[model samples]
Target: MKKIIITVVVILIFAIIAIYCKFILGLASQMANPKVSTLEKEMSWEKEHKLWGDYDDYEKEDYIVKGLNDYDLHVTLVKNPIPSDKYVIISHGFKSNRYGAVKYVDSYIDLGFNCIIYDMRDHGENAKATVSLGQFESEDLYKLIEDTYNRYGNIKLGLHGESMGAATSLMLLAKKPKVDFVVADCGFDNLYDLIHTSYSVAKVGFVLPSVNTAMKLRYGYDMKKTSPKDALVGNEVPVCFIHGEADTFILPENSQVNKAATEGYSELHLVPNAAHAQSREVLGKAEYRGIIGDFLNNIDFK
Candidate 1:
């Protein structure tokens, strides 16, 4: 009887250890190697250059900024045809590069705002190996915002991001960078919640709890503490959130909840038949341009 009890206890301990190891490995792989879908590859601007004629006509200056942990981030500063102090920092989504932000540049430029599009760590030319999701990326954004202020001096700033980029922008609110407004497109509310929803009940039972712990142990960042929901709550900045009603990847509900958390200062726009980051295209050129233009016009920039 004693031997049987000891054997059962040992088996349970080994099972727990095995579960922890598997969870940690899976979480690490997800963060390190984000897979880009075939549809997303086809969505690149290089493949659709004709859609944005004269995109090459604009002059872009290459800039480098240092992140919180000394990670060097590459940036392309796209000055408007006519110089203006009004600027917008464009952040692209997960598993994407600065080109992912190219589509939105025209709208801001049309509004007479200069654009700063940067590659988040691990996604573009940056040397970082691990994706912090939005943890360190948010800090990188804050640094870029600060660098913009220090370089340009007293400029009206706005932030715009898509998907993970949007979540990073939302997280940036906690840093309290001096800015005019924010535009978040198809952003998730919380990192853990997003991951949790993406997995099955069986996976979540073991994997969800160790995700943050593994992140902290291996990557040295706490995943649970970083979220757009935490940043947007009671945030005084006027924010405009756009999401595709047809999006199931992150779901449009994330935006709805985030908009609700903004306490009446934010505007939410839902585009029909669009799936994640396809709002501008699905809304058609004229309507999309009008909606963005109106939002920018309403902001009382300094």
Candidate 2:
């Protein structure tokens, strides 16, 4: 009777562990596989925020750059009519496409910069694939940067990214790419904490560790290792970190943390009452543009 009871308890313990692991894997899968918005949804937001000019009217040059594993990255170059060698590559947030990054075009152009806005993998025109959160994203953008130099030839380059893109921009510092400056807006410091904060799970101590294991098993990347804060170690790239003060999602503290970690000239701006990726929308174009301009001036980024 005692032996039978002990066997049943062991079996129940194994069953509970299996159930918990299954749940953790589900969360990891959901986190990596996000539901991307349609082009129409992306364009509508672009149309709303891009109040000055019609995006369709720009001198647009499109291309398909090769990203990690030779994935096709849908890219577009919006040329400034003023004839300048300056360029700014803009990376949009998760679930958003190149069109979603249109709001920043006019501001960059006004600052005498040609804009290159591209769709990140699994978002926009690119074919569906596993999102690395920001692990391979930094490498993918590095590929685009290399291609940009090959195509444009001797151009003054800069980077501007929002949310995931912001994290991507900062993470690329690990490669030590030759870019003039980086403007990171509302980016997370790392994926693990981001998932925890986003889901607001109560038993995170029990939940996150299993999810980390699942992330490695399923996605070929570790959530704990894929961190912007770690990526900033010894990176000397001039970065302007912008975040919304009221952003409970990514939290304003992320920018503060990254600012402290960055080895280069770094600045943080927390927009009052702005939530998540709404810093530019809340600050207005002029104020937002001024911040970038001021950063460039402070860095002497000519």
Candidate 3:
């Protein structure tokens, strides 16, 4: 009986160890080469459900922009005929490219704002497939902002980002804090929570902590360094946080926490029955446009 008990204990220990190792390895692999398959899935769902709204006709210019650490980034410049002094930079979520946010181009363009959309380092037309989330991608956005300013001569700037892109935009604001206004939609407050939630949803238990440890080991910064909550705290920039009430991926509370963290002008809009980026879909095109238009109009874009 004693021998059997010892054997059972040993088996349990081995099982735990195996699970930990597997989780760490999986996370490391994903961190080294973040896949955009999830983004593609969401996009396919949106298209099948006819979620995206009609976009205004605009000329699209494809160009290669310089990224951080000598990496080249790809971007699509959507220009409006009016050519107003205001510019809006839109960033897509994880595993998504500029096209994912194309539905928003027309609204901003209609308001006489030049819209610039770009692919992150690993996703879209970008050459690399590795993503450190927003750790490194934030630098690419900063460069794009600088390029925009240099060319357009310090025009009023607005940033619109969803999910990972939203996190990246918040980090940019923390690092620079110069944007006239920001709209963060369905973004996670902390990277740790996001990783844990994602793994849980995938039925991969015990992977979150292991992956987080490996991330810290591989890169100097942990999830806290990439936290939008930390970035938004005490920030004086005008920010609008739009969240879906039924969002399970990142949870609506994440947006609430981030909204609370902002010390300056901030507003939160919880879409009643929406899920993740489904606010626009649930609210319909006209209502969605009106909400965003009202938010933009309320901000002093000087």
lDDT of every predicted structure (CA atoms): 0.81, 0.88, 0.78
Off by over 4 Å in 1: 1-20, 32-46, 49-53, 201-206
Counting clashing residue pairs in each candidate, in order, gives 0, 0, 0
lDDT of 2 at 31: 65
Off by over 4 Å in 3: 1-19, 37-56, 198-207
Tens digits of per-residue lDDT for model 3 on 1-302? 99999999999999999987876867676765776644466457557767544443577777888879768888877877876788899998887787787766766776778889888888877786457667788888888888888877968888999888888888777785567888888888888778777877789757676676777777645765778888876688888888889887879898899888988788888999898777767877677667677887677554
Worst 10 residues of 2 by lDDT: 46-55
Give the 10-residue window scoring lowest on summed lDDT in candidate 1.
37-46
Q: Better model by TM-score, 1 or 3?
A: 1
Find the 10 residues in a row with the least total lDDT in model 3: 49-58
Which residue pairs show collisions in model 3? none
Q: Write one digit per residue (lDDT tens) for candidate 2, span 1-302.
A: 99999999999999999998888878887768888888888777666666434467779999999999899999999999889999999999988888889888878887899999999989998998888768888889999999999999999999999999999898899889989899999999987888777666454555787788888888888887778999999989899999999998888999998899999999999899999888888887889899999999999977
Candidate whose TM-score is highest = 2
- Which residue segments of model 2 deviate by more than 4 Å? 1-18, 49-53, 199-205
